[model samples]
Every structure is written in C-alpha cells, then in structure tokens.
Target: MIRTVVLDIGETLTRDDRYWASWGDWLGIPRHTLSALVGAVVVHGRDNADAIRLLRPDIDISAEYAAREAAGLGERLDETDLYEDVRPALAALRAAGVRVVIAGNQSARMGELLRALALPADLVVTSGEWGVAKPARAFFEHVLAVSECAAEATLYVGDHPVNDIHPARAAGLRTAHLRRGPWGHWWADDPAVRVAADWSINSLAELPDIVKAQE
Candidate 1:
C-alpha cells in the first residue's frame, strides 16, 4: 500500500516560470538567457546550483535570497502559483487517509512558504533542513525515515527525470514523473529516463486514480 506521497516543489506543485524570470531581471540577465542556463544544466547533467555559479561566480545564493526577502519577494508562494490540479489531488489523497508530504530541494523557508500559502500537506521538508538534497541517496533515506514508512510503500512525485525519479526509484520508492515543467517536457523523450519512472502523469488529476489502482 502507498501510505505516503512525497512531492517536489518547483515544477511539480508550483509554477515558477514568472518567479525565475523576475529573478533573472533582478540579476540583470535576460530571462531567456537564464532559461537557457537552466536547460543547459539539465541537458549536461549538472546541478542547478553549479549552473548558477557558472552564470554568476560572485553571487552568493544565500545573500541573494536574503535580499529578496528584505524586498518582500522571497519566501512567498501565493495560491495562484500552484498548478490547478494540485489542491484537488492533495485533498483526495488526504481524504483517503494517505499521508502527503512536500519535500523538495528547496531553501530553509520552504516549510514556512507552504504554510503561508496554506498548502494541504501533512509535512513539509527541505534540503536546507535535512542538510542534503535530492539525487542523493541520503536524502531519500531521510524522507523514508521521516515518513516512518517502508520505501516500498511510499510514492514520490516530481518533475525531474534524473534528480527526482531516478534517485527515488533507486532508493526503493515508486516514482511518478510529472510531465509539466521544464525537466519533464525536455526529458520526456529520453527513453532511458522515461523508463525509470513507475508512472508518467501529465496532470495531478490523474494521481488519485493511480493511487487507487495501487491500493
């Protein structure tokens, strides 16, 4: 039985295209240029932080976030930013007595942001809190420990093919490749990565049915 479902934040639960574009503007880079950097990072199998460093060697990520927070831009996620299917899917899962967790490779304020947005999750976690990030075995192990459930009885949903799907599957959890964001649309045709996910979903509306089937 799939007792727990852990979700990725960026492209899976929330849409951040505009937010990233704003960040690009703040950094004096064209949004398209910043987007290209993001695509390049995924294509080259590089980490997002490494790509940011390559783009701006002098910028400290923490300081940048602090600046944004001071400007009342960071640490805020509005309900409109979420995908349309997210709330309904989460509600269904929760109503069915499944534990839902929002655990992602996010900053320290992720839990706060989720709470501020009033997202329906039983627990929220971040790499900053856990001291490890996704695509790492330790991160998935930590998730399993926190969920207090066996890996085989858990499901992880995310937009990344390599970072999210592959690692979670390797860690013995079922994975659903949510095909909506950059990673999903870009890597959708990659046969190797495509085969790694136990399921591929274009919408979170499809999730409850998938969970039901599992049960």
Candidate 2:
C-alpha cells in the first residue's frame, strides 16, 4: 500500500504555463527562444537568479517571477482558480491516511507559494534549501529519511523524466508522470526507465482514486 504521496512542485503541482508565457510575451520572443535562453543560462553555469538577471537587465526579473509564482499566476491565465484541485486532493489523501509531502527545489518563496495556492502538505524539501540538485540519489533518500516514509511505499508524482521519474524509481519509489503538454513525450518510450504510472490522469482530481488503488 502507498503510505505517502510525494509531489514535485514547479511543473507538477503548479503549472508554469503563464509564468513561461509571461516571460516570453514580455521579451517579445517566441517561447522556444525563451527556452533556448534558459538552456544557455544553465549551460553557462548560471543559477536561477543569474538566469533571470541575464534575461531582463532592466527589471528585477527574478524577483518578479518569484512574486508571481508566490501568487500563483498560471491558473489565472487558464481562467481557473489557483490550486483548484490541489487543496482538495491533498485533503483527500490526508483523509485516506496518506502522508503528503512536497519534494522540490525552490527559493525562499516556497511558503508564500503554498499559502497563495492553499496547498496543504506535511513537508517541503528543496534542492536550493538542501544544497543539491536532484536526479542524485541523495535527493530522494534524504526526503525519505526525513519523512520516515518507506521508499517502496512512497510514490513521487512529477513532470520531468530524468530529474523526477528516473531518480525516484532508482530510490525504489513508484512514479507517476503527469503528462499534459508539449514535453509529454520526452520519455514516452525508454527502456532504462518505466513509464507505467500508477495512474496517468492529467488533472489533480484523478489523484484520490489513483492513490486508493495502490492499497
């Protein structure tokens, strides 16, 4: 039985559609260009703050992104209330005796983001706070150790293949790739990794049944 559901924050819990789109729209650049710019920044060994600074020299772009993310802007763009399904899903999991924790990389704005979105989770673990990027065994093992959840009974739901699925699987945790965008097929087929999600639904509304079935 699944005793805990560990979630990834940025792409899985909160959609980046508006955040990315806003950045692209503000710079008058296509989305792909924005993606390329971000890639270049990462390639150049720039951290998140540095990447944002290089993107828009005129404004404190990193702070702006942080504020907007704290306020949950993506749902607004989709004409939906932010955290519409998040709170309810979390409550359901809690009701079903499943521990809910957020394992992600974020800056100091994490509390604000969860408050703005009204997401309830038992713990929040981040690479920035932990001083390590994920896809490393330490990331998964650390969270499991801290949360006191068995690696085999803890499931991680995320959007990224390598950073999320691969590492979590290696840690003996089940994985659910929340597929719902252009990057969905990035690892739809890979032998080194398994894509058989315990559940493969898009919206968070489908999570309750998914978790219950694991028991």
Predicted structure with the largest lDDT when compared to the true one: 1
Name the candidate that leads on TM-score.
1
List runs of model 1 lying over 4 Å from the truth. 71-73
- RMSD to truth, every model: 1.9, 5.6
lDDT of 1 by residue, 117-194 (tens): 777789888898889988899999998987768998899999888789999999999999888877888787688777
Clashes of each: 0, 0
* Candidate 2 C-alpha lDDT tens digits along 110-141: 53445454457777666767766677898888
Candidate 1 differs from the real structure by a C-alpha RMSD in angstroms, to one decimal, of 1.9
Regions of model 2 farther than 4 Å from truth: 25-83, 185-198
Clashing pairs in 1: none
TM-scores, each model vs. reference: 0.91, 0.69
